[model samples]
Target: MKGDDDASVVVAGVRVGSFTRDSFVDRVLTMARGDSTRVAVGVNAHVCNLARTDARLREALSTSTTYADGQSVVWAARLLGGHLPERLATTDIAEPILRAAAAEGLPVYFLGAAEGVAERAAELLRDRIPGLRLRTHHGYISEGDVSLVLDEIAAHGTRILFVGMGDPAQQYWVENHRDRLPAAVLTCGGLFDWLSGSNRRAPAWMITSGLEWLWRLMIEPRRLARRYIVGNPAFIAAVLRQRRHETPRRTPSGVL
Candidate 1:
């Protein structure tokens, strides 16, 4: 992904790329077919909150392209007077991208998730899209495993590598090894969890109404309680503060 597009929106001080779902998928697949390496990451309230305080995370985000991955982020952009096409949940976009990759006969790699989770997700994908060239590795890798994982990725001739080790860590891993990778990379937080059936997505109605976080909280309250209950308000407050310091700008579409 390239640097912020002309129409990119600053939400809570993080630049979120304005791309329709199709365009983003096309860009990623195009990058996979190219020689040079590029990275794309999804943005949500959790990521925005972290980027506000973590310089390293901010650096990772600044270098890679970003997309709106949460409804809250899309709402925040609208609240701050910017336009994003839609909320592109990483899980939703991954299927289309993989389908395209399958049609093109490009090898795709899934790296992250707990042991056997990525493999399970890969199995589901293989069933979903026949003839998808895919490979997998668990996210729990030791320092010595880095070289092995890279070798496997290279050996598999991966064109796109989806890293799902969660935020900051996944971003940092890509940042640390960007130069060594030969494929287009995307940091996908918890995508494997959903795909592997370890977590369930919200109902379509909840998702469309921007209550997916509530569903997530309902299912995994102990884990996500702080993130949603505490972090969400903090993210909203930060966006409001940012709005106070900046002037709203009219943006056009299709700049990227």
Candidate 2:
């Protein structure tokens, strides 16, 4: 159900896969070849902090092949004494995923994003990744329509599904429908907007410098202020608390 040595690490009881971007794409390609179904997800500081309070989101992650999608989360893992290798940010990785699907001839479904965004993203991907078998549906989907969407994906033989509705909503939809969807599901936050050029990403310097959050905050202050300003600090506090709890070491006498 998971990739080999998936590098799954637990933070505050939520599991996150630590594979490099390349390794993740390879695993998806292999899964597609075998027609395996799984839920692929990602995490950031806000998501981690949310999981601490949101049992539903936490439970959903516990069942997924998750990744640390934010550099800040990776750094927090290190601060908590976890051996996370790097950031697996979704924006940086979506292209490689599409490329893998194109090469392997995997049928992919794009779900979520505003009206027409998913289709636009699909068109962009097909143009860039020749031979990509892509389909799309906008986020106008409602609760009553979930089963219909599942049937559509299954009937079309979708191999990989990307859901970009953001946060717990995206994760919840995939978790609830994955059983009937017949494809590996990826909870890709805002990936469509980035790919469709509806959202502008920061320069490479900002991303590498771990200030991508700042750039996003600058762009959508009203929307993301609480996530970065409040959630980031809370995540740091949780990691430091985890670190403290790990520190009651054995004495040199070899006894507790």
Which residue pairs overlap in candidate 1's backbone?
A: none
Model 1 TM-score, 2 decimals: 0.94
Models, CA RMSD each: 2.2, 5.1
| Model 2 residue pairs with clashes | 17-66
- Residue 189 displacement in candidate 2 (angstroms): 1.6
Q: Compute the lDDT for candidate 2.
A: 0.76
Q: Would you give me the overall lDDT of model 1?
A: 0.87
Worst 10 residues of 1 by lDDT: 247-256
* Tens digits of per-residue lDDT for model 1, 1-256: 4423447887886888887888888889878988888888899999999998999998877767788999999988888888888999998999999999999999999999989999999999999898999999999999988999999999999999999988889999988888778658999988989988888889999999999989989998998999999999999999989889889763433222
Off by over 4 Å in 1: 1-6, 250-256
Q: Please write out the lDDT profile of model 2 over residues 133-233, one tens digit for every residue.
A: 88888877877987788788887788888888888888877766665765577888889899888989899999999999999999999999999999888
Please list the C-alpha lDDT of all candidates, in the order they appear: 0.87, 0.76
